[model samples]
Target: IQAFATLFQYGTFDRFPNLKFVVLESQAGWLGYLLDRMDAVFKGPMGATTDMKELPSTYFRRQCWISADPDERALANIIDYVGADRFFWASDYPHPDHTGDYIEALAELVAPLPSDTRHKILCGNVAGVYGLG
Candidate 1:
């Protein structure tokens, strides 16, 4: 959260517009709260914090991606809060903690989302972010 706040406070994204950031292992459920608070602060007393061309949420949506554990119950909700195109599934495989089939869990979690959203979360988002074709 601090890293994202600092980057936004310093206009990092505005300076290096094409730089992409992928946040790994950070369960994506809290982004909505963080962004909401950040925006409130940005619009309040500390509005002069930076010469940011846009709000923190705007930069995040444009230049960042976050990975969600396949078994996260809030995944679909998180994907909705933070654009579906900004998320991808992650499995803490071989980590001695995760269990079961990651693919199966992911498939089930994304079943109710639209096809395009599911596709992006499954693969398209990551590929596009990294120029992976």
Candidate 2:
């Protein structure tokens, strides 16, 4: 797990620069802490030194997406840091971990956001990310 974490921290999604990675079934609460730790480590002597032009979090914020299981508060906090463009809604339907009513749950989760942001989380963002549009 630690090794994968390190890889995730240092790896670049260069093969899919235009692609957005949506991490499903992973809780949103840890993202901020992880990003913070990654940034700290990158700036520290113990971390990898690469030719990348930005912080690790900046890369993640640019290329990653995540799904939360109705954990709106935690998700909202992450969005505040990474911006709403980096997240999307998932029903995880027929999966025991998610609320069965995925669409409604997404609606509720995005209720407080502006229309554009909600649109991104619900459809627009995923469409663009997956090249489905």
Pick the TM-score winner.
1
Q: Which digits, one per residue and each the tens of the lDDT, describe model 2 over residues 1-133?
A: 2542554544545544665566777667788888888788778875556544567787787877776666556676678888888877766667776656766776678888888877887788788788897
Relative to the true structure, candidate 2 has a C-alpha RMSD (angstroms) of: 2.7
Which pairs in model 1 have colliding backbones? Answer: none
Per-residue CA lDDT of model 1 for 74-126, tens digit only, reads 87777777789889788877666677688788878888889999899888998
Each candidate: RMSD to true structure? 1.4, 2.7
Which segments of candidate 1 are over 4 A away from where they belong? none
For model 1, give the 10-residue run with minimal summed lDDT: 91-100
Positional deviation of residue 62's Cα in model 2 after best superposition, in angstroms = 2.1
lDDT of 2 at 76: 67
* Candidate 2 minimal-lDDT segment of 10 residues: 1-10
Poorly placed runs, candidate 2 (over 4 Å): 1-4, 14-20, 48-53
